[model samples]
Target: MNTMLGFLLIMKAEIIRGWIITRRYWFRTLTGLIIGYGMLMILIAGFFYSQPAIEKGINQLDDPTRATNYILGFIIGLFAFGVIGMFTQGIQGMAQTGVLEQLCMSPYGLVTNFLARAVVASVTTIFYSALMVYFVVISVGGKLYFDPLPVIVLLTLSFINLLGFGFMVGGLVLVFKQVGQLTIIVRMALFALAIFAREEFLQQGWLVSALMHALPITDASICLKYVLVKGQISETGQFMSVFLHPCFYWLCASCLIWTFIGISLFKIMENYSRYKGTLGIY
Candidate 1:
């Protein structure tokens, strides 16, 4: 009871502090969301708006499955872009402002600092996703078959998944000094792979599933569709798949492991920065 309040207060402080820093670097964050939401909604509009024609055009599966698949594909596309926005902005902010170092000076652990930035970024993401859904409603001209409650749940889980990506990318930034190049390639890959190009994208055949599962983004997409489009949150399979998802949890666990790694890397850089006298200034 009392302990939970204390924890909440501390988390609030961390988020507030991160929020302040965010104002100083507002362009990248704001521009990212704006561009992301704009582009995504346009594509989503195309898909749902075109679905009726697609179903009528093909005599294959009658009505519902065609529409269902269309909606599922849109959900994955949106989530993939969400991942790109999250990791891109996350790594950029850490590398640009050295916020990681600033937060490290505090008594709070790195995990708190890491999570705070995630929350701040999540504020923007939440807005964008809501707007996307609203746009989806406008395009489709209907409400969901079931309550949207399950999607909200899956969205929260997806945020946890994003945390793992943020930390891993931040780690790369710290070690490599500029992972900017890899960011582009990763962005393209996420779009191509998760945007519904393939049916068994992350979990198909043994070999393909093995490869896709190795990347957390893959399972995150699969689980996302299950919970969001299908309203399968109560399913044992969907929930269990989350725990087994490599990119989402296994790597998320690794992020906690890498917090220590970040500390060690920061210590080494601290020494070098002190010798070079560039630690605090830049």
Candidate 2:
């Protein structure tokens, strides 16, 4: 109980710190949002221009599910990067500014401090991502079926999965100290997976399907689509069908497995870094 309470207090303090930083740098935050929105618009324009057939098909269809799915996938990719960035970019920045060493020496420990930051980052990213999704949906006239319960449940799972993946990357940062290029490549791969992964991929082959299901975002993306875009709820409007789906179970398993692996790997890397006296080296 005391440990949990201490962790909660740490999270609260981190949240307050995050809020202060955002408030102080409101202009920078707003500028980032504007730039992000502009980039998204450019991508949409390029996509439509490059694929005339898809554009025409979207025009002809009343629902435009394909377009909606594309937008959702983009949003998911952004959320994933944002969550993971809290560890990758955040740690790098701290190291460059000579604050990382101080953090390593703190009584709270690196893991506890970083976890608090992750929680705050996730909440902030979700808010901004939701805002962006809303604007994109309105601009494109896209339709989405949003049941609050399932959406929340699926998003929570997705966040947990992403958190674990972030820890894995964070572990690499602890040991490597300079993995910018590699992290970029990995994030790009994850973004591509988010956009294109689907249940149909599972039908290709067992090995291929297993690998896809093992990815952090694949099952989460599919589950989110089922609830938000596909509207695969029961006749009674309950989310039982979603909970009963195989992908849902796969998501649960992925969350457990990835989280355990990520945390364990992070611990190993942290200890090695400490032994090498490079935990705070940029």
Candidate 3:
């Protein structure tokens, strides 16, 4: 009970710190929002420009539902990028500034500290993603089906899944300290996967399908699309169908498995780095 209380206090402190940082850098935050909006506009313009050629190859952008799918996927990709960045870039920044060792010395330890940070980052990421998605959808005249309950549930699960993946990458960072290129590659892969992953991909073959299900983002993207794009709620206005879906189960299992793997890997790598006396080395 004391451990849980300590964890909660750590979380509260991190949240307060995050709020202060954002508030202190208000101009920077506003600029980021503007930049994000500009980039989103550019992407939409490019999609429109390529619609003709894309139509000939694949009839993907002809309908509102399809457009919503693409937008939602892009938003999810952005969320994933932000969450992962908190681990990759955040750790690197701490290491470079020589604060990494100080954090490791905290009473709560590195794992608890980082987990608290992840929670704060996830909350901010979700807020920003939702804000951006809302404006983009309005600008594009796209209609998305949003049931508050299911959307919140799926988003929470997706956040957990991404957090796990972030921990894995963060573990690598603790040992490597200069995995910028590798992190970029992984981020790009996740971004592309978020945009293209669909339920249909699960029908390819057992091996292929297994691989899709194993990814942290694949089932998440699919589940969100079902709720947001396909309107998968039942006639009784319940999400029982969504709850019963195999992908949903996979998402739950994936969250548990990946989180365990990530935390375990992080602990192993953390110990190895400490043993090598390189935990503070940038």
Clashes per candidate, residues 3 or more apart or on different chains: 1, 0, 0
Off by over 4 Å in 2: 52-63, 233-240
lDDT of 2 by residue, 167-253 (tens): 888888887878744787778788878877788888899999999988899999988978777787554676555888889999999
Residue 233, candidate 1: alpha-carbon lDDT: 36
The lDDT values for all models are 0.53, 0.81, 0.83
| Global Cα RMSD, each model | 6.6, 2.6, 2.7
Candidate 3 lDDT by residue in tens digits, 83-194 = 8888888888898898888888887778888887788778887888888888887776777888898888999899889889888889989988787447977887788788
Across residues 106-224, which tens digit of lDDT does each residue of candidate 1 receive?
55544455555456557655666656555554454433344455455555655555455545554445445456457667656755555453324544677986666555455555555
Look at candidate 3 and tell me the lDDT of residue 262: 86
The order of the candidates by TM-score, greatest first, is 3, 2, 1
Off by over 4 Å in 3: 51-62, 233-240
Strongest candidate by lDDT? 3
**For candidate 3, what is the total of clashing residue pairs?**
0
